[model samples]
Target chain A: MNIKPLGDRVVIKKIEVEEKTKGGIVLPNSAKEQPQMAEVLAVGPAIANDEKRKDEIKVGDKVIFSKYAGTEVKLDGEEYTILKLNDILAVVE
Target chain B: MNIKPLGDRVVIKKIEVEEKTKGGIVLPNSAKEQPQMAEVLAVGPAIANDEKRKDEIKVGDKVIFSKYAGTEVKLDGEEYTILKLNDILAVVE
Candidate 1:
């Protein structure tokens, strides 16, 4: 990505919601809520004086973020969300 | 006044919008947008490693905060807004 996130911000790509159930039933798009799960594409530098928060999120990590917490951006015809570190609720284990 | 803000949060009471213009003409409520100015009532402890941010805001200071940036709260029948430091736009002179 050409864009670099600055100051405790993260760039993420939303993971597409699964369209099929395990039982082979297809689900309609309207039936699924917007997915909160995202993959970390790039992470900004840590804020000064916050050592513990540094390295907690790394590229390729799957994370769950709060709904309505990020700014959406379009780059190279692809969509991404930029979020503050505080917006990330948890790392998907 | 009894509720304490936590984790870099600040409690503020919105300053009422002026109802009269300098020319002494009365203005209707609809003529005014929600005021962003407020009086700082209380402040929470600073986050670790951010000493510069500490003491930047204090009780009794007049401040301007970002619109839609705080949580509305009620205490003892009075309304207040709890906002993070990041939501505070500037300290009014």
Candidate 2:
């Protein structure tokens, strides 16, 4: 990824939900809502420079974000979401 | 107003659109879009503490904000909007 986010924005890759059930039945894409969970791919310079937020969110962190938040973009045939730091609700440990 | 905004939020009172036209035709509320201009009532601590923004926005300053931004609130029979500082697009001189 050659793209870098500006301000306090973050780049995240959505973590796809499991399609197969315990019974081995595969669910269709339409059966599920878009997952809000994502892996942080990059953090913007503002967040990086902020002493408080720099330690809170980092690249490779698994996070849960607001469902309706972020702008979706396709880069190199891969989809990612760019959103402000405030949109990320929690970091999943 | 007794309301105090948190974080980088601000409280603003919307400037009502003129109902009467030059030809003496009175336009109904439904005929016009809500005005995006407002008067800054108060600014949050974070914005006030920031050296750059403190000089940029001040109480009683007229400002233009994003159309869909801010949370509407009714207080003491008057209406107001509470929004983040980022939602304020420009200060009207």
Please list the C-alpha lDDT of all candidates, in the order they appear.
Answer: 0.75, 0.80
Instruction: Assess the local accuracy of residue B5 in candidate 2 as a C-alpha lDDT between 0 and 100.
Output: 58
Q: In model 1, what lDDT does residue A70 have?
A: 85
Clashing residue pairs, candidate 1? none
Question: How does residue A3 of candidate 2 score in lDDT?
Answer: 70
Highest lDDT model number: 2
lDDT of 2 by residue, A9-61 (tens): 99999988776877999888778777866899999999889864577678998
Q: List ranges where model 2 is wrong by over 4 Å.
A: A1-93, B21-23
TM-score of each: 0.46, 0.49
DockQ score for candidate 2: 0.02
